[model samples]
Each structure stands twice: as C-alpha cells, then as structure tokens.
Target chain A: MSQVEELKSELTEKLGSDIQIKTEFGDDVLEISKDKVFEATEHFKSTGRYDFLMDVCSVDRQEREKRFDVVYHFYSSKDNRRLRMKAQLGENEKIKSITPIWKGANWFEREAYDMMGIQFEGHPYLKRLLTHHEFVGHPLRKDYDSNRQQHCSKAADLHFEDDETYVPDPNKDLIPLNIGPSHPATHGTLRIMAQLDGETIHRSNVELGFLHRCFEKMAETHEYNQIIPYTDRLNYCSAPMNNVGFCKTVERMLGVEIPPKAQAIRIILCELSRVIDHIVCIGANAVDLGALTSFFYLFNMRERVYSLFEKLCGARLTVSMTRVGGMANNPPEGWFDDVLETVATLRKGVDEIDRMLTNNKIWIERTKGVGGISSEEAIAFGFTGPCLRATGVNLDLRKANPYYGYDQLDFDVPYGTSGDVYDRYLVRIEEMKQSLKIVEQVAKNVPGGDFSIRDKDIVLPEKKDVYGNIEGLMNHFMLVIKGLQPPVGDIYDATEAANGELGFYLVSDGSKRPYRLKVRPPCFAIYQSFTQLINGGLLSDVISILGSLNVIAGELDR
Target chain B: MSTVPTVTRDLHAESEDLLTTAAYTTRFDKLVAWGRKNSLWPLPYGTACCGIELMSVMGPKYDLARFGAEVVRFSPRQSDLLVVAGTITEKMAPVLVHIYEQMLEPKYVLSMGACASSGGFYRAYHVLQGIDKVIPVDVYVPGCPPTPEAVLDGVMLLQKMIESNQPRPWKDNWKGPTQ
Candidate 1:
C-alpha cells in the first residue's frame, strides 16, 4: 500500500469504526467523532508520523444536523503527505483544544472561536482573536449580518486583560509602555503592551485586530470569482500570491486544469511578489534597526517589481491578476524583457545590501543570537515558510508538495542553522536570490499558448467574439451574469506565501458564492509566539524580532 | 537757517518713502502664511498600504523635500500638518483623534488615500467610514492607495490652502472649516 493509504488504515484501526475515510476535492479527509479527536491527534503526533499542524479551522453549516466541522490539517515531513481530519459538533457542543499537542493551534482555535463561535473546551485563553473586544456577533456565522455595526463608547473599554494567569509582582518596579497601534517601529497597526523593569522587558503582550477589515465575512458574500479582489488585501505585501492561491483553491474544487503558459505566468508573478515582499520585510526591518540607507537601496528595486506588476496588471500593490482557471490577461508585449531587467536590477541591489549589512558590526550586534527558536519548538508552534525554514526545518510546501509545475523550476530553499533574527535575515536574502533565479528561468521558458482555459464556462469569451458571434455572446452572458460554480465539497489549498503557508480553507455548496471561506494566515501563527520570543530580551529587541518575523497586519488580523 | 531746515525735511521725506515701500513689500498675513506653507512638518500617520505610498513620496525620486516638507515629524506637537495615510479602524480612531488634538495650532490635515478620506472600499464594521467623522480633513486624495504623485499633489493642494487662507491668531474668533 502507498504511504497515505497505510497511514489511513493505521489511523482507522487505532481510532476504531468511529473514524470514516473519504475523499473530497482530491484531498484525503477522515471524519472522526468529536471525543476521539484529541486522542487521535496525540497518537498521530507521538507515533512520529505527522509532526506539522498545517492549519486548524472550523466551518459553520447552519442547516445541517451537525452544524460545525472543526477541521484540522496535518502534514508529515517523513512521508511527504498531507491529511485532513474533521470532527463534527452540534449547536453548542465543544471540542477539546489541541494546544497541548501543537502550540500553534492556540491562535487558530481563538480565531475559530472568534469568527464562527465554536468553543474549544481546553483552550487556555479563548478570547476573541480578530475582532473588536465589544464586537456583538460572530461575523462568520451563516445567519450573521455583514452590515451590522458593533461600536464601543470608549477606547479604554476595548483593552482586555491578557492571560489572567500571570499576575505582576508588586515588589518589582515594572513600568508599562504601549508601543504601537500607530508607532513607526511596530509597522502596521500592531500594538505591543510591554512591562519593563529598567530597560529589560519583564513581560510583553501583543494586541491585534486593529487592522481587521472583516475579510472572511466579506468573502462569504462575494461570488467565487468576485472574491479574488478580497484575497489581495489579505497579504497585501505579496498580493499576487494570495490571488493565485485563491484561484488555485477554487480551481482545485472545480477540477479544472490551467494551460502551460498560464502556469509559467503564475510562477513569474508569485516569485516577483516574493521578491517584493522580502524587500519590504528586509528593508523595513533594517529601518527598525536604524539602518535607513539599506531601505532606499532595497525600495528602489521593490519599485521596479511594482512597475513590472503594473505592466502585467493595472494595479501595483493589489494586483488581482489571477482568475479561476488562469490569469486575468496574458503578459503584455515585451513583459518578459521587463521582468528580466527587473531581476538584474534586483540582483545588483541585493548584492549591494549584502555587502552593506551582512557583516556590519552593528547589524550583527543587534540581530545575532536574538529571538532564536529550536527546530522542535518551531514545529510544535506550527511555523512554516521562511521562518520555519530558518530553524533548519526544510518544510517548504513548494518542494514538499509541488503545484503548478513548481517542481520543474530550478531554485534552492535557503535555511539557517541558528534560527536567530540574523539567520532569518540571511535566509530571506538568500531566498530573494533564489526567487530571482526562478523568475529568470520561468521568463526564459514561458510557453506560447492560450493564457486561460479553453472551457467557455470557466473563462469568458473574447470581447470581439462576444460582440460578433451568438455562441460567444451567450457564453459571455452566462459567465458575467452567473459566475463559475464549483462542485459541492470542501478543499484546503495552501501556497508557500512570502511569510509562510497561506492556506485557503474553502467550502463550496455548488453555488456561485462560497458557503464558508477561512484564511489560515501564516503571520497569525508566527505572531502567537511573539510574547515568548521577546519575554527576556531588551525592549529594543522587540522591534528586531517582530520585523524578522515579517508579520504583515493585513494577513495577521484578516 | 531756512535752507538747512528744507534739506533736513527732504532727508526725512526720503526715509519716510523707504519705510512705506517696505510696509507694502510684505504683508504680515502673507509672510506668516508663506512661512507656514513652506515649512509644513507633516506628522505622517501612515497605517496601511497608503503608508508605503506616503514613504515613496518622501523617497529621493518624488523628493518631498523640494516642497520644504522634508521634516516629517513623528510627534504631533512638532508637526503642523497631519497626513492621515491609511485605514483607521474602530480601535485606532481614538488614537488618531488624540494625535490630531495634540498637533499645534495652524494645523492642516491631508487625508492621503481612499481609506483615510472616506474609508475607501472597506465599508465594513471595523473600519471607520471616513476619518472626517472623527477629525476635520482639509484635503482628500482619492485613490485606493493613491500613487506618490497623487500624494504630492495633495500636499501641494494643502500648501495652496494654507497660502490662500488668512492665518488668523488662534485667540481670534476665526474658526477653520468644520467637518
């Protein structure tokens, strides 16, 4: 038997007849009783099979007898396989929290609780994750109104006590400092509440939801294709990746295959986006360290990438450039030339930055040996993408599960041994070089063919054809009036986003609009470990650590 | 003695003529307005994507320094103009209001993007519909995340407003335009 099948049979035998095996949207899904979930998860983890908790989310099906499905996604690095486990719950039923097995489930559970009103029984601090403290209703519930406003009278009332277990010592002279929600060092809308005892931080608590634009709530109301624009705002730094990720997820549900040219174009756009995201991450992180000169050198290259994106699509920052079966449009004339030129400029600029800051005494002193995490801790916390790789985990989804012909592309995954802030910096810099290499290869071998799928139902006909031919007109009318409808099933599609694994947990009910859409933001996972990382460090190191994580507020609070 | 008096009188008349020309050369209001317009220390309240565009405006290419607004201050007390760059969520609205109130008198606000101006496309519950609901905005730049050039244009428009409007003392009964 194949590894997945063996594992499935083993899990079924271990969990008994209560577990049922099924496949939906080309993913292996196991349905388990709610009570057996914790035991099964422990067995799976302790057996040295599945070590990574890729994502944990809950979907609400209001009309069903079992109203909620608490979905858990697991990946096994040893077998190079992924598994989905679901536990059903009725209206007020609570499931055990998996935080003990995987600490990364802390925030994801909180998010599920916050959005869908699903209660995780053993979650230590089960509070609202991405909504205002006084938010009235669960926004992601099927019956909740999207237009309902929940307002609080005063901002002071919005501050909730953080993890009430830790009481401050009255003997120690701890001074409270509020860092952000608007401060330049905190980047985007993140507020850090730190209690310091003479420049050394005694304890720090992170406050999020300041940039929550209700994206998931908005996604439910939008059509399958209409939701592309909303994905762009999820991780605005690498928007095309989110766009392509969403499109790929819906396409996976539809079981449609895109053409070769579209795949090549998708690779170019996603890699370019990776370069841009890294530039912003590294540049902004440097600025936080008082190395402002590197920011200019890097931002110039970022602008070039943005211009290339502009050339490819109309928008620069929010490039909703991908559609369901393919891209919005083919690359314009000489687009490859523009991409190559940008790649060359990016290489020169990155090298210049490398020389300027890589071995700089100040840079090393500030970043080295700070915010270091071991591989085991990283895995337990569910770190992915560059941050996980920086711990020498080698857990890149692009390599482990190749999609869109990523296996054919020539590139290297750079990792760090120490997992320090400096190592993350090195990893990102190296990754930028690798991304540029991918861009060069993809640009060289871009195939010449249809940019979108030939299926009339999936893609709208050309404007000229629609204007002239009756069949073309009919197809256009059908597509425009009623959007693409995928099969009735749920699928979890994840891509190696610049920050980490950005997964879309989509549930479609054979309708134009999705029944439920959940975004498993990588930054959300990374930010959960922030308090532990910065607990004993100096107050200034907080900025360095936060920057190194590259936590974009758009994704974190989405 | 009579001829000496006439020569002294002519000298006094010439001095008086120089004094009158100097008075006409620079009006007090115009001088104050020019100083305020030329040296606008903008407190960049950049919160989101528009914040990046605002940074681009300050970069070497756009060169905000050319307009004498190079000194982008973080402290509201030091700043004369408030450039609200990105979205203001419900949680952030009070902080924004406090910052606006902390700015020194003769202040101007340039709402830098769609979010800042009118909450743009994010008309959801969390996002504040428009910053104008909380604080007064002088100029509103219209773009989802307006280009750097558009932001520069907004800055120039604020300068024009400063130059045209008379800078009456705060003690005077002249109130600025209310939201």
Candidate 2:
C-alpha cells in the first residue's frame, strides 16, 4: 500500500475513527483533532517515519466556522513523500504543541502563535518569533490593517526562564554578549544573546524579526502577479529562486502547464541562482575564518553572473524573473552564450576557492569538528538541503521530488558525514559545482516553443496584439486591471531553495488576490537550532556555524 | 576646539609655513570639510538586499576605494558616513536609530535604496515607512535595491555635499547623547 493509505489506516488504528484522511491539490492531508494531534505527530515521527518536519503555520480563515487551521507539513525520507496534517480550532482554542515530538517545531510553532495568535498548549516558550513584543496585534490576521505601524521605542525586555525544569546555579559566573541585529560578522540583523564562560558559550537566546517587513500580510492584498516583486526580496541573494517557487505554486494551483522552453529556462536561471547563493554562503563563511581572498574571488564571479542576469532582465539583485504561468520575458538572443561564458569562468573561481580554503590548515582547524551535529539530531531539527545532506542524510528535494524537469537533469548530491561547519562549506562548494553542471547542460540544449503558457487567463497578450487587435486589447485590460481570478482553494507547495525547502502555502478566494499566503522560509527552520548547535562551542565557532548555515535575515524574519 | 586644544592653535600660529604655502587664504571649516570629503570613513548600516548592492560597490568591480570612502567600519563610533542600506522595519527602526545616535558628530546618513528611502513596496504593518522618519538623511539613493552605479553616485553626491560646506543640520544632535 502507498504511504498515504498506510498512514490513513495506521492513524485510524492509533487515534480511532476520529481522524480524516484525504488528498487535496496533490497533498495527502490527515485531519486530526487537537486532543490527538500530539499523538498523531508522535506517530508521524516514530511509526510513520515522517522524519522531517518541513513547516508549521497557522491559517486565519476569518469567515470559516473553525476560524483557524494549524497546518503541519511532514516529509519522510524513508517514504520519500510529504504529508500535511491539519487541525481546525476556534478563535480561543489551543492546539497541542509538537515541540516535544519534533524539537525543530519550536520556532515554527512560535511563528504560528506570533502571526495568527493561535496558542499552542505545551509550547515551552510561546513568545513571538517574527515581531517585537511591543507590536499590538497578530499582523497576519485578516482584520489587521496593512497600514498599521507600531514603533518600538526601546529594546524588548524578554527573559527565557529555564523552562521550569533546569534552574541555573546562581553562583556560576558567566558573561553575556549581544551579537548583532547589526554587527560585522552576524551578516544581517540576527541577534543572539550568549552567556560565556571564558569564551565558551554557556547559553544563547536568538532574537529575530529585526528585518521582518510583513511579507505574508502584504501578499494577501496584492494580486497574483503583483506578489512576484515581493517574493524577489525573500531570498534576495537567489531572488529568482523565490520567484520560481512562488510562480510554480500559483501555476500548479491554476492548473496550467508552462511550455517546455519556459521550464528549461526556469531550470537554468534557478540553478544559476543556487550557484550564486552557495558562493555567497561559502565566501561569507570563509571571511569569518579570516580567509578574505576566497570571498573576493567568489564575489567577482558573482558579479559576472549578476551582469548576465542584468542582460536577461533589467535588474541585478532583485530579479523578478518568473511569472505565474511562465517567465516574464524570454532569454534574449545569445543569452546562452553569456551563460556558457559565465559558467566557464565561474568554474575557475570554484577551483580558486577550492585551492585557497579546501586543505588549508587554519581553515580545517577552525571549521572541522566544530558545531557538529549527528544526522539524527539534524533531522529532528528539520534540517534540509545542503545542511541536512552534510549530516549524511540524503534528502535533496530536486532528486527526491523533482520539479521543473530536475529529474531529467543529471547531477550528483554531495553529502558529508560529520555535519559541521567545514562539511557545510564543502557541501556548498560541491553543490555550486553541481549547479554549474546543470546550468551548462540546460543552456547548451535550448528548448524551442512559446516562452510562456498559451493561456490568456494568466499570461498577458503580445504587445503587437494588444495594439492592433480589439479582443487582445480587451484581454490585456482585463488582465492588467483585474489580475488572475483563480478558483477558490488552498495548496501547499515547496521548492528546494538554497538554504533548504522554501515552501509557500496559498489560499485563493476566487479573487485576483490571495485570501492568505504563508511562506515557509527554509532558514527559519535551520536557524532556530542556533542555541542547540552552538551551545557548548566557543564564541568564535558561532560565527563560523552561522555563516555556513546562512540564516538569511530576509527569509528568516519574513 | 577643546578636543584639539593647542594643536589647532599652533597650526594657526604656523599656518603659512605648515600648510606648505605662504600666500594661501583658506577658511578653517573649508579645509576641514575638504579633508572630510575625501577620506569618508563609511559605517555601512547594511540590513537587507541593498546591503548586498552596497557590498558590490565596495568590491573590486565598482570599487568604493576609488573615491577614498572605502574604510568600511562596522562600529558607529569610528565612522562619519552612515550608509543606511536596505529596508528598516519598525522592529529594526530603534536599532537603526541607536546606530545613528551612536555615530559621532559630522556623521552623514545616506539612505540607500527605495526601501530605505521610502519603504519601497513593503508598506505594511512591520516596516518603517522610511528611515528618515527616525534618523536625519543627507542622501537618498532610490531603487528596490539600487544598482552599484547608483550607490556610487549617492556616495559621490554626499562627498559633493561635504565639499560645498552644506550645513550639517543634524549637527544639533551633537550637543548631548540622546541616550
């Protein structure tokens, strides 16, 4: 029997007849009650082998009888499939926190509580994740005004009491250091409060939301097409990846198929974006270790790729390259030539970085055996992409559940045994090489067809047709004035983003705009384990680990 | 004057010979401004995408070192030019303000990118409308994330502003630390 069928039967056996299982928009959903959700999730991790907890988010259906739907996405590497478990509750109702079952659910659950104000019963620290304490309302709720702004005049006074279980010895002397919301090595706006015992980190508390620009709340009001530019800022380093992920989800929901050429082109751009993302991560990590030359070398190559992107599109960093049905524009003539040239040059950069940092004693000493996590711990913390692979767990979404014809593309998934800072760096370097391979393969064999879907409902008409043809003009007006009117439904789709699995949960209300849109940003999962990963390590190793993880503040706080 | 003490007094006494010219008549403020304009120690207040563009400008391609504003200090205490590059959410607003306040006198705030200048398209609950709402801005480079060339232009404009002896109206903040 299939995993879904087996899950249904098994869940029925565990929770009695109180559970409901059905497939919606390509996802096998198991609807369980609040009282039994803890049990169901326990079964998911243990018996069902749904080892990876991809995302946990709450949906505020302002008009629905249940009012709120707490969603949990689980992926089992053993089964190589995803299952969505949801529990519907009232406005004031509290659901079971899965933190005890899956430790990675800590931040995801806190995010649910913060955004939608859905209380989790047993969550250890039920504080806000992506907003300050002074923020008045749950910003993701339908009633929350988009224009409402809350100013935090001072720093939040929050203390994470030792969970009522472990009281610290009052006599132990330790020093506290606040690293960033803006400091050099912290990269972006992530803040970690670390208590040090002579340079060794004793305890740490991560504070995010300093860069949260309300991406989810903004998407609810924006049209299907308008949300494209917003997604660009999600993972600004790999802007096209976010665009593709969002567009692919909407296209899948719209039930439209992009042309072969668009699919192939999407793959090329996304792979190129992945390459750039890895380059930035590795370069930044190397800089933390005082290897500055590799950063310069890698970034020079990054500029070449950015210039190529500028030639394809008009922008550099925030390239909103993809659209709902297909791409915004076709790859210009001789673009593949540019791609090939850049790819050829980028490989040398890869080699240069390899030569510089791969076997260097200082680099090895600084990174190896530092911030290492076992494969089991990594999985329990819901790690994905290269970070998960570095733990010796083979789970690349591109390989396991291929999208945009990733299955046809030939490339190997590189993995490391010790899941340390060094392994992450190595995995990222190898992934960049593999990405270059994919880029070369796809750029060589350019597919020929319409660059976008032929559907008039989603794709805009040609400029010539808009100018000359009456029907085309009207069609253009309708599309531009009133955006895509998708059928009323909700779907959860995830793509393997550079950091991990970037998932988007969308609910359409038969309007041009989405009723609700929740982004399951990848780093949001990996970065939550900061305290767990860096607790016993020295202060210096923290920067190394953070850089390797690349907890992009854009996605982390968004 | 008190900070410099006898250094400026002795320089004034020996102005003719010390400056390597005997007949030169230049105002002290102008000379100070000229010196400040060339070697602008910029503290990059980078928080988002525009920060990446800021890095690009500082990198080898469109090197910021060409204009002599390349000493990118992370500490506010050490910098004169505060290049606020990226979006400043309300949560990040206090931090931005704190960083701005932490900067010494004659510090210039160059609001970089559309988001930093005016919140770009992210006009939502959490985002601060523009950083100018919190800190005084000397230059505003506009783009979702401005191109490297545009960022370079903004820096050059600030240098020009410095050279022309524009009043540092934000200088009023130097009277006493707000905190």
Which number leads on TM-score? 2
Interface RMSD of each: 2.2, 2.0
Native-referenced Cα lDDT, model 2: 0.85
Which candidate number would show the highest DockQ if scored against the true structure? 2
> Can you write out model 2's per-residue Cα lDDT over A1-558, one digit (the tens) per residue?
976777777878888996678887888888888788898888877774787888888888889988998888888787577788888989988888889889999988888889889999889889787888788779888898998888788765433446323334547757767788788888758888877898898888888898999898889988988999999998888999999999989988988888889998888888899999998888888877788878778889889999999998989989988888888878888999999999999999898888888999999999999888899888888888889899898888899888878898899999999999899889988999999999999999988988888677898898889999998999999898888988888888889999889999988889999988989888888887788889988899898989889888898888
Model 2 Cα shift for residue A388 (angstroms): 0.6
Real contacts recovered, all predictions: 0.36, 0.82
Query: For model 2, how big is the iRMS in angstroms?
Result: 2.0
Looking at candidate 1 chain A, the ten consecutive residues that score lowest on lDDT are: A152-161
- For B1-179, candidate 1 gives per-residue lDDT tens digits of 11111112334344656544333345567677778888999888877778877877887678799999989778889998899988888777877887877988978888988888887777676788888877777888998788888888988887887787744343244343132
